[model samples]
Target: MEPGQLRVFAQYDRDLTLEADAVVVGSGPAGAVVAKELTDAGKSVVLVEEGPPFVPAEYEFDGGLSMARTMREGGLRTTSGTVMPTMQAVALGGGSLVNSAICNRAPAFILDRWCSDFELERTTRADLDPHYEAVAKFLGIAVTPENVLGRRNLLFRDGCDALGYHCEPMYRNVRGCRGSGECFTGCRSRAKQSMDISYIPAALRGGARVLTSVRIERVLAERWRATGVAGRVVTPFTGRPSHQVRIHAKLVVLAAGCTATPVLLQKSGNLANRSGQVGENLQFHPGVAIMGIFPELVNPRFGATQGYQSRHFLREGFKLETLWAPPAITAVRLPGSGMALKNRLADIPYSAIWDGIAVCNRSIGRVRVRRRSMDPILSWKLHPADVSVLAQALWVLSQIFFAAGARTIVPGVHGIAPELHSLEEAEVLRDRPIRATDLVLAGNHVFCTTRMHGDARLGVVDEMGRCHDFENLYIADTGIFPQCPAVNPMWTGMALAHRSAQQIAQQI
Candidate 1:
């Protein structure tokens, strides 16, 4: 069935009530997978999303407009005690609609650690292989074609090779990609195979209904069992509350990403946080970028935004990847004022940027609900060890840039020299006392806010993602990850949701 044939309610203005065997909050990767799998098993499902449906034609390539219409908090959400921004998309497909389409399976070591730490004997890598394979096949996951790798990506690969480090082409869920380097904004060509184009459509075809522009305020429970959800429909353009809405289902699945899920549960009078762990242990793959001034034009915005990555330092809690953004976002990250800034803007075509991501950081954060409100108060503090790891990553990125024949490198650190000409000068960066305020940090991956474990005292859900306190309530997002997966969490989160859906089907 075509997408147009799906039952999507986007502009219902009157009070409404929906009923299903399972109602999934959030139409992201996890919720889409769960809905599709359950519908495939002949169960009725309803996928609810807080944001409106946006097609590729609606994308105008304007960063500010895109954020205002599709992103959470108009892309201005930040941690309470720090300047670090927590990026999350609030569309029908959630982050999958705006992300770079990178797909990576969880590493074996990370899976092993999760199994041991969470006592999830049934969640071994072997147990998850089939689910991962299914998701990959469904999404057409493959190594990005060599022709689409832009010059910036090749430069990063050349630098890694010159330094005897390994860099590989990233796997993405795209077909016929034009390499427009606009994935961070929505994909205007619709070439990228996001959840909206893949799983959600399949679910819709298989009898699942999707309701967009509906905010779920609370999960309705009766006698320790999830009965439904209640909320209101908001105006698509302004997000102003408009009409009351309710969804009653035999089972409820919460897949509203890391931040929204915990906050929703907490705001509902701690419905499923029996262990006091609903909004704790939040971890993110915090990343910082280094810009190299090359002599020739790089045209960073001409190809796939992210096409290559190096995990050579994965065990050390960091990874390296090449990234490109539109001139507006790039200018915001570039440091300068007056003439200095103007000069850098003019040199955008000659600048090459790559990110050093600290994936296994020990930093811990939390999400708390403000009294009498649905908003979340998020806070995170980087540990000393994690700060040192970021410093090491900076040193490594500088070396790679220099090896690739960059004349000057600009480490985007506050209270430091703007430009470094030699490795000796870059060495000073390794010793500088790194502070969260001194670095430009961004995180899109969030996990472990409502972790899953066998021990109810330490986790909110069990190994199968079923809430320990309620038989009919389950979680199917990265928020239930036992620990940080040390990689892009999309594929793993979808695979876990598939498993959870299978479990729920068997019980039903």
Candidate 2:
């Protein structure tokens, strides 16, 4: 069968089978790029996604309902160790549909560490710069302009300036953003260059096919070669497994993401476990947010959801960034419910939330698959050392808030005072020993579930993203990173996918 049109499994009444030159799983950043590049190179490609296509106009505006509609597990997926919440988008565009569109390249230090520690060399800046440039140009990536940095985002710069630390506008994968601060709910204006609006459509135009609402259950393989994948169609509303699907192809690219990909591999009879690292070495850029109530109207609802950032403390194990969420979602985490919640909700416009993303590069974790179930169980804990880093970050944020003329700051640490009335009160947290359970945290940037290495015994895939055990099987997602890139993973993920797709094109 030729690859040329979009296919929605929900519309099918029976089993479906397809044949293509290449089959790419998950229509996220990595998979979309791989599919587009292969199709652009004249190969017939079929992209399969478990979730339906991301439809911007149909997105929920309220944060709570938005999560219910777009996020996997209704945004309730949490870590097994620390019990902190994490989010994974379930749409065709994946997290890009809900993310703030921050686009950052991997730092040189991270690349060097991967080269030295993980037996990687082809991932060096010299080898990947062109690919990164290509992806950036296509996505219209650039530093968020000042005009879009409304008062809420500008305050972050004010705080950094007052403290003599440099904070700059973030590079975002967006075009003509209107500062609606609605990035977390999906960009209704189609301004954010999410995969669905960019590469996925481009791939369709290039004759690549997409199948939505189809879950891949297993990999079909013989000896050392992958033949295809088999899965079931999913009913959208009830999420019931309905009809079946099978795709035969010469190449199979698994980009099911860091958290889900390993489970997919395990469910496929533990493929590529020679190194015993399919779901091992999981890492997260865990983040904590502090709310600052300004003396005046900071208008939290109006800004680029997150447009400014401070990477100055990266060596200190965390980086600070501005953040905002709808009042409904933010209210659920407040102290109380009834009128007390109403009072806090009234302060929404006067509050600004800035977050600290703990690099946690040295912290280790894992994702385990249950024997009887195919669901991935995340097992991660905030290390004591990383806990201290977050404490310092919170303290720094308090100081920054006060520096920017805020009256009081909410630290939200369980052991500490609930509200620090002044900057002097915040200094006590500078040396406070924070336990892992004392703070409410969340992580969305997950990495290293199937890392790449030069040696076949040490990693699941090679630097080129080909599985060590099979020439035609590839895994092109954040799972292949030896470590978290200490920033947003989308840009690096796309960069690597671009290079890997080129490599595959050359091979075929």
Candidate 3:
């Protein structure tokens, strides 16, 4: 049965069943792109989201409250192994709604490695660049304009230039960005072209039906064929099941993210796991930051959330980027309790924060699918090798800060001095051994939970993102990456989704 047009929320209010040509779960970047692609090709699509659509005006601006509205478990989700906090978005646009809008293509070397090392065939820059180009055009991606590169970012650029390292403005999916620097709390300006403000609308225009506030339980599969899905309407705030939901479709696309997708399959039983590779090779670009305190005020709050970066150190296992967040979040990392901490918080206007994301392909982990929970238990450790890389990263950033004329740098690593006063002191971080448990790190880029391979024995999906065990089941998100892309994964994930959509369109 055809569902009513446009938006349908939990307000639909009863047992609702819909049938369409395709059903795409998760209304984030990949799902939104695929919904538009299939709908534009004249296939009716139903896009399901577990979270409600967000309005910019409703943004609470408080970190805890904002997480309550946007993230799973109010941002308390964490990894069990080396112990760094992580979060998954529970909103319609996924992480795009809270992310800084940085956009980067997968590096050519990483793609080449995927084919050479992970059995990915015909997957290279040559094959994927067109899709990347299309996504860039559709999102209005461009370099962050200098007019909004406030002191914090400009200082990063200055540091890079002084250190003779290559640095450039970040490419972001925003139009007329007013640089309110509130990207994490939700872009108040609505200038950030997150999917809800971009592709989801296009999908709607193309006659796709969007159903929000529904949590998918399992694929409606029998005899290894995806028939449809069965789920229930969930109240986004209360997390309570309200009504029954069933969707029948010709094709099923899973874009429910790395952790959630595998857990969904686990709940569905024997689907997508013939090779037993559904949630095995989890990887994330774990990153840590250093705060540089300068005598001059940097006024860190008035620019793009992340506007400058250096790729010069990518081969060294990390990428350096300038970062900004509300003082409430940053101040916690400052040392001392009492008046000493007071002085530190008061110095926020004079400080700038920079971070390095380790290219962590070797630090493989697994997502433990909880049988009765929406959230998965992640077990990942920072490899000893990655620990050294993290140390080297902090050391390098400290050098850049000193070169840029900062008075002091706060490394924020445990088991080390709280503050570094000179270049000589910073050397200890790199020259000596540091445990992975010491670094305060977080991950936004996650990959490889449902990696694609040409060999059926080795991977959960094929090169075209089709599950090895099912004909019409496709996975189109970062989860299909054979390795972490080692950069922002949004733009690259969407490009791959477009490729999958094209493949499906041709076959159907």
Candidate 4:
């Protein structure tokens, strides 16, 4: 087999047989890397995905439909009585297709915290630098330059600078972007080098097989050993049901994700590891967007989703990220309807809105078992410290935008848009009461559910990414992160997958 030369085993055209050296579920960065490494090591490998292949020409500009099709739970917004329900992708390339393509490696401070708090080895910046470089090179990560930063992005940079915040160019997994600014939706320009264009093709070239649009219901375990996986094919568009299929494998790697991974584990009735931590310790960088109504058109739809950011408040458990929103979505996010909506939409092309994401880093959330089904009980509770940071971060974002000559600032929180004329109005938020629900938080980055730790009693997976109790089962997704990295996690996810795949290849 060569890259892009694998056969599509249709659901109706069944040819079931599984005796691979390793079976990797979910053909995202994690599964693709694992499969490629295993096949490169001369092991037979099978990769399974839950979404259709990405065709650049067929890509759309609307992120909403993309989120519904490529994300789990249709990117549902849930509050498990603790944390807000966030979005995670289920596309052929997983989150790579939907993310901002920021390829940030693990900061030394974060890695140090991992080493000191979790007692994991080989996670230091020096130890992991080569692996990080290899992953970055593989993804073709590059910094977004001045030519690519459109008016919308430059406006954000100006605001950050005027506020005395450290802002820099972000590295993305893109080759030759034309600055269409539609990275959240599928990239029609074929600039964003997601796993669909990178590792998955390489894996297929190395004789790895891929099966898409198939849902894994449960892992078949025989006396604590994973022997096979069973699931049904999700019919296209019509929501029709289909028959179940079983894949037998000598080794099984679970890259389903933080929420789905533990559910699959619990469904197998293999709860041997009674640490009760397989699905706990979930983390998400709860973000809030500040929409500033500027006199000039911040036609935010003109460039990358996040090209610049404000890191002045990073030590305060939050960072300011400028995000993009299509005009239609931005209309709905406004405070009022009718005349007000028309007024905002009329100037949509000229409106320059500065979006800010308040990165929440101090909260610990979890996933619990629900009924007999494998649906995760998503729950999260924000610490008071995180709430305070969000307040301060939002205040700073508003002040900066105002200093940049903004008229009104619409906080993404679900209340009346705070029509601020001056920075003093923004300062009141610091003392005002803030609640988790009051802020507009999203689940775009869910991590640390099945964390990697040195102790068996504390973490679900070891530093090598193998499960604490199950020998053949492994976790190679965001679920395995011990803590949420301060920046975009896709690159870190890929690097960690590379490291884990190497370990799995050596053993299997």
Locate the minimum summed-lDDT window of 10 residues in model 1: 1-10
**Global CA lDDT of candidate 3, please?**
0.89
Q: Please give, for residues 1-508, the per-residue lDDT of candidate 4 as tens digits.
A: 2322453425346634556778888887777778888888888887877666767765656656655666666667575655565876777877787777887776788889888999898888887777778887877888887787777678777877886778887788888877777787777778888888888888887888777767777787788778878876666433344656678887789888777788777776745356678778888877766777778766566677677766666655666776776555567666667787677667566545554444455677777767855567887887777777777777877877887778777776654344555677666666678887787666577788889889888998887788887888888898888988877777777778888888878877
Tens-digit lDDT string for candidate 1 (121-215): 88878889999999888889999888989888888999999999889999998987888999988888788988888888888889888888889
* Tens digits of per-residue lDDT for model 2, 68-164: 8888888889998887888888888888888999988888887888999988877888778899899999999999989888887898899999999
Per-residue lDDT value at 429 in model 2: 79
**Cα deviation of 408, candidate 1, in Å:** 1.6
Report the number of clashing residue pairs per model.
0, 0, 0, 11
Tens-digit per-residue lDDT, 305-409, candidate 3: 999999898887889999988668888789889988898888899999999998998899998777578789899988998888888899899999999989888
Q: Tell me the whole-model lDDT of each prediction, alpha carbons only.
A: 0.86, 0.87, 0.89, 0.74
Better of 1 and 3 by TM-score: 3
Candidate 3 backbone clash number? 0
Best by TM-score: 3
Q: Which one wins by TM-score: 3 or 4?
A: 3
- Candidate 2 matches the true fold with a TM-score of 0.97
